[model samples]
Target: MSHQPDERQLSLNAFLHDTGHHEASWRHPESGAERIGDIAWFQDIARKVEAAKLDAVFLADGPAWWGTGHRPSNNFEPITLLTALATVTERIGLISTASTTFYEPFNLARLFASLDRISGGRAGWNIVTTFSEDAAYNFGLDGVPSHEERYARAQDFIDVVTKLWDSWEDDALVVDRESGDYVDTSKVHAIDHVGPYLKVRGPFSAPRTPQGRPVYVQAGSSNEGRAFAARNAEAIFTAHQTIEDARAFYDDIKSKARALGRNPDHVKVRPGISPFIADTTAEAEELSQYFNRLTVPAYGLTQLEKMAGTSLRHLELDERVPVEVFGGAGNVLDNNRSRRQVVANIVERDRPTLRELLHRLAGGRGHNVVAGTPVQVADTIQEWFEGGAADGFNVMPPLYPQLLDAFTGQVVPILQDRGLFRTEYAGTTLREHYGLPRPDSQYADEPALAVGT
Candidate 1:
């Protein structure tokens, strides 16, 4: 399976998590949980991913610890860690998740801009309206804001941030030692934005980045999330249980972008995939089962309760999961839609017992999980890309170093050989890597007629 010179190439991002994505990943013998706090460990992962020619390295984060304390949760601040990783890696994009609900637009914009500058234009922001109630409590809120309210705030927040990013024009800097004119005042303007969710008066402190601005990425998958992503996102991260479902989501989001007069191709859809790979399918399955055996069922049940927004601890482990807990497929939630559907899909499709359901979702939470030989894993990735289910994927390894090495060493070569993925770095900046155009500053140029006439 090979394509001609001009065929579309896939985009891949290595999602960085301590140890790996499986809930029990830290328990695996090969996983180095002791090195979780070491920046060198993350840098090594970034370097390896860059060597594979993947598009980027994504770090997921939130304000509060999310797990049941049975495993290590997110510790590193994404932007800070990516900034350090940027120092070691050159070509790979650095994407950091920052919550719209938690950060002030100006502050968040500055951090992303700083990262973009530090990384030499290889920066991206994964916009998220945080869903964790624990996170809300950390902010001293009485309760989590309603989903509608959060999205509304997010819209205003992004508007302000984008304006701040565009506050300085490309030619604003004129570092002439002769006349000592450091900046051109005419090219810089204050946004003076006053919105429902944010108030900012600015010209950003930072200058324009090489890509003009950091690439805008989104990760929510609800109806409102789809609308937001369609209107503004350059790339999106999502989760799905099957190829058909992923295709449905991809088509729907692209259609939405088209209806909004946005370039559909500019909005790349990347679903997360957690692969447990080995030389043989049986060995891969065994490897996966080993991780499942290490899983703490009480922790999994607690997590399920949080996802479903209902209690399940009383249910017998051997009995099938309660479908009514999800409010059925049609009634699936809009706030945490992806996870809700994952729970519902498990109940309706497999009708698995509570214990079985936990095992199934142990790797990726809600994303597709495949345990197979390297070729089998590559086959699934290729099928998803060619079949319109994904532009690529947020590759989540089940265990760090081991699975990451297997994928980059084994699976990526197959993709490169098939002409589905790139063998060498095509571009340096994140925007170029994603095939997105660098946006002209919103402050650029006057009307053609006004200028000429």
Candidate 2:
């Protein structure tokens, strides 16, 4: 595929993890697990990401520890870590996953607002609802809320947070030192929001943030999640194994956005890509296998059990898992969109062995994992970008620093040469970098606005 003179270049974000996305990445010799807790290591990586001119850097977080100590479960909190990262990186966006279920609207709003200001309009929030029972227990809840109930809470949670973000008009902070009149009280508004789940009162302490509000990013593929994202999310992070599914998801989300009377193009759809790069295709394929060889089957099975919500003790590791085995998640898969459906799709299509399934997942969880030369990797990206399967790809490296180096130092140059990605940043803010407009405040400029409540 070739880009026309006026055609747009796709976006790319660095989906960085403590070691990497691979389950055994920490065990890899090239991984930076030795300094995973050091802030300087992340800072250095952020600098490299900026030098590559990426759209953003994202970190996935959970309220409670993830997994049962199979890997590096204790990770630095995304918002907190990105706040420190903000001090070092100048142009790239800082996106973090925050749970709407665990944090109050007021506190979450302030955290993002502060980050946006400190980063000079580079903050993006990946909104999520806490689903783990362990997370719920930490918050003193008896049990996790039902899927519908948590989503209901998430809807109100987002509404409340945005209301607070928009409580102050763009021109509310008028620091007229001579007149001793520092604030325009008339311009400020108190978003007296009373929703089914939350109640918040009065104007926010801070003024309107840079980029109006940090770009609303969400990651969910379930029906309720799609509806919520269609109305609110400016960017979506989704997962899929094939181009057909990716295209279908892209169309579904965009169509939903259009039906909501929002511009579909404004909502960029990016699917995850876990790439293993080498000079030659053969070498790259072997590189993936090398990492797969390092995987711990016990850990993978435990994770698989979590994903399928059923024990797989009866199945042999080396044997190919029957399609009926995933009928195991029959009811569970219907409700949960991400986990159970991924490998089931693989089984129906390629029928990989049970151990092979673990190996594949050990790469990027459920993301598309490819091992090839930089040119081939760029070709894969271009085909998807041009064929309407994606607006961009979330670059998730299996073995970080080493794999990240290969992607940026090797693959990114190829993408730049093909005119598939940008070589230099053209904007200062995350919204601008994403080709999204800085939104008007909830009650600014426009006199009659239907604020969500």
Candidate 3:
């Protein structure tokens, strides 16, 4: 009920992957694959996204090498890369994913604060409890922690970071040379936090930010992930291949947040979508086919194995994906929940053969894939937004620059003309873009305690 009918402006984020979201995008003749690691390439794309009046530019990242194969993997670290893009763009929000499992609270808190300052308040944090065995090895662990254990650590981690961010009150900084006093030390307070997972002592290193804290963006969709997002996230990035599924998730997350005493409207649900656009429907289909043809079956099988948490290399590509191979993740509380859900949906809906499934997932991982003319693409997007399936979408172009150019140049105009999308940015800060309020420091009422005293 908190999602009022009158407020219906679409919220879009340009989810920037290397060359594109398509697994074989780098192999495409039109993509700018060679310059995947180039900062200028990212800046160029960010500028394009900003020009379209999109809400933000999001970068998805993980610490480990994604897979040993032909597909182009994400190269740059997200926070640092987004920080660099922030210097060039004025209004677009900069969001980056960082794992709670691999990072300490204080360090991650400081980094986000620095980015918020650098971007003039347009900053967001995509909190992820990573689920990679290789990532654990990278951080000197013998094996990955259990799902419940990771989320437990994540909850504690977020608490510590929030306290650290709130350490310096808004009025603490009083730069007055006339009085020869740089700051109001009396206003700064220490958050002496002690928890099961971490003990972070503060007065923090950074001062209060323009937004108080970076906008919290969550992408997990498991039961625990849903609860966490309900309690904390202002925005959610999710993957669902159908309108029915998306609408269900949108309703569930909002209702959960409302039950938790949070405003449902404060939590925006935006699903990832990769559109193949062209002048004609037939042309668009051909373009999608071109990308699908380029997909490597081996790579898809490998990625699928990772998703289902089972080996499928022995299965023939022509055979239908067996439901039994997953060992029934439908009711399990602690499997690769998101990916398993994707495979389950695919199985239930179409029962695709392994070859067909690879092509189906080639575009946006588990997110929706649509191929059509600009008008058709706009229609699909509008339907989802109006149908309560999405607040907006994470616009993932299959091939960078060219595909992105088409979306911005062609599809975006249709959305704007239909009055479903914005023509220009309404606000400067990321919170404002997402219609979220800026938070006050939590330590505002507490007495100051100087460091080391």
Give one digit per residue, the lDDT tens place, for model 1 in 1-453.
455544688899999889999999999877899999999999999999999999999998889977467989776888999999999999999999999998988889889889999899999999999988889899998777888889999999999989878877888799989999997767776887898878888878877988898999999888888889999999999988888888988999999999999999999999999999988889999999999999999988888888888889789989888778788752233434667876687788778899999988889988889999888998899889999999989999989988999999999999888888898887889998999999988987732111101
Tens digit of per-residue lDDT, candidate 3, span 270-360: 9999999988999999999999999888888888888877888777889898877766664323435876787777876687898988888
Candidate 3: the clashing residue pairs are none
lDDT of 2 by residue, 253-301 (tens): 8999999999999999999999988989999999899999998899999
Q: What does the lDDT read for residue 18 in candidate 3?
A: 86
lDDT of each: 0.88, 0.86, 0.88
True-structure RMSD, every candidate: 3.1, 2.8, 2.5
If scored against the real structure, what TM-score would every candidate get? 0.96, 0.95, 0.96
Which of the two candidates, 1 or 2, achieves a greater lDDT against the reference?
1
Off by over 4 Å in 3: 1-6, 328-336
Can you give the lDDT of residue 20 in candidate 1? 95
